[model samples]
Target: MSDKPLAPAIEGWHTMGDQPHLIGTRCTACGTYFFPKQSHYCKNPDCDSTDFEEVELSRTGTVWSYTNACYEPPAPFVAPQPFEPYAIAAVQLEAEQMVVLGQVVTGVDTEQLSVGMPVELVLETLHETDDDIKVTWKWKPVAA
Candidate 1:
């Protein structure tokens, strides 16, 4: 029983911590960064090795694209009783060579967002319960 809050994700699994993190996969032949992870096999067509190693991703990235969720998400995702509009965006991690999509933090002014804007990842609590707390990733515009 650790003092840390129990994560909504799998328990006992080490948390990614406060820093923006990205998943990385080494080609074994030619190193390459991968997000969402290539668990099955390497995407580098030239190599057939089934071996891969996980690596932490970058914290900052540039916005590749963005959209607003005018409606509430369906199913198991719990939201506030009245519902609120949220923003989702795809951030391109140049170092990882991949695009990671996540919800924007609350109070963001959508009109101020733009493509190619610099952003950084932040860990936030989405929901909580007596035993578990749902945590997810979010992105915010970099401070000027």
Candidate 2:
């Protein structure tokens, strides 16, 4: 359990150890779905209404892209490192037509990663501070 604030943007990723889910908002008029859930406005560009409601995103998706972070990202991301490489990946939520990116788990084989490979969400620990811990969502290959 990370000491991080429970951000709604990552509700599914940092789970209570259950199936993970992302937050989303569906435009009632245009039938468009947005991740990070737009609660006030529609971004369809086709809809002119300001009505939106929050919904849970699909738990399952596919790997859209992947890479490794060889160097530390600039400040605000608090992970002290000797700069060991870490895997980062983008997952595509088919149901929402959206993508979410995060750091993949360590000690796993990533060479098999391919676009369109099935993945499931997981709660990933980012870093811990004295005052707060930060957590984010991640995706990995689904188990048989």
Candidate 3:
């Protein structure tokens, strides 16, 4: 049981530690980029190319939309004890022209966010155990 943090909640999404950016796949044929990586084939409906290259997505994006989870989710979804609401946002990466959804970093709430607000990617602990801490990517509103 090494002390290092556990693997990412979803493998191959983002690297851990300083200077992290979401890992995505870019279709060399159509110039399409996909987060979570598209290893099988190009996602562009008009293209049938299977060639892709892994690339780091932009670190900054604009808040395209947001919502708050006021209620605890059903089973299989774990919520922190002493349940508290969390904010989620759809951030539009400028270079990719795609919106990625993720939880907002702690201390940021719906009140502090608005459409078109600048945001950056961050790594956060989703949960921890005696052995390791589960990490995931989160969105944080950029400072003025």
Please name the candidate that would achieve the greatest lDDT relative to the true structure.
3
lDDT of each residue in 29-57, candidate 1, tens digit only: 56765665665677777777677777777
Query: Model 2 over residues 61-142: C-alpha lDDT tens digits?
Result: 8888988877788877666566556787799888788888877776544686778888887765667656554556777788
Winning model by TM-score: 3
Error of 2 at 126 (Å): 0.6
TM-score of each: 0.83, 0.81, 0.92
lDDT of 2 at 128: 62
Candidate 2 has which clashing residue pairs, if any? 12-21
lDDT score for residue 24 of model 1: 54
Model 3, residue 88: C-alpha shift (Å): 0.6
> Each prediction's Cα lDDT score?
0.74, 0.71, 0.88
**Candidate 2 ranges beyond 4 A from true positions:** 1-16
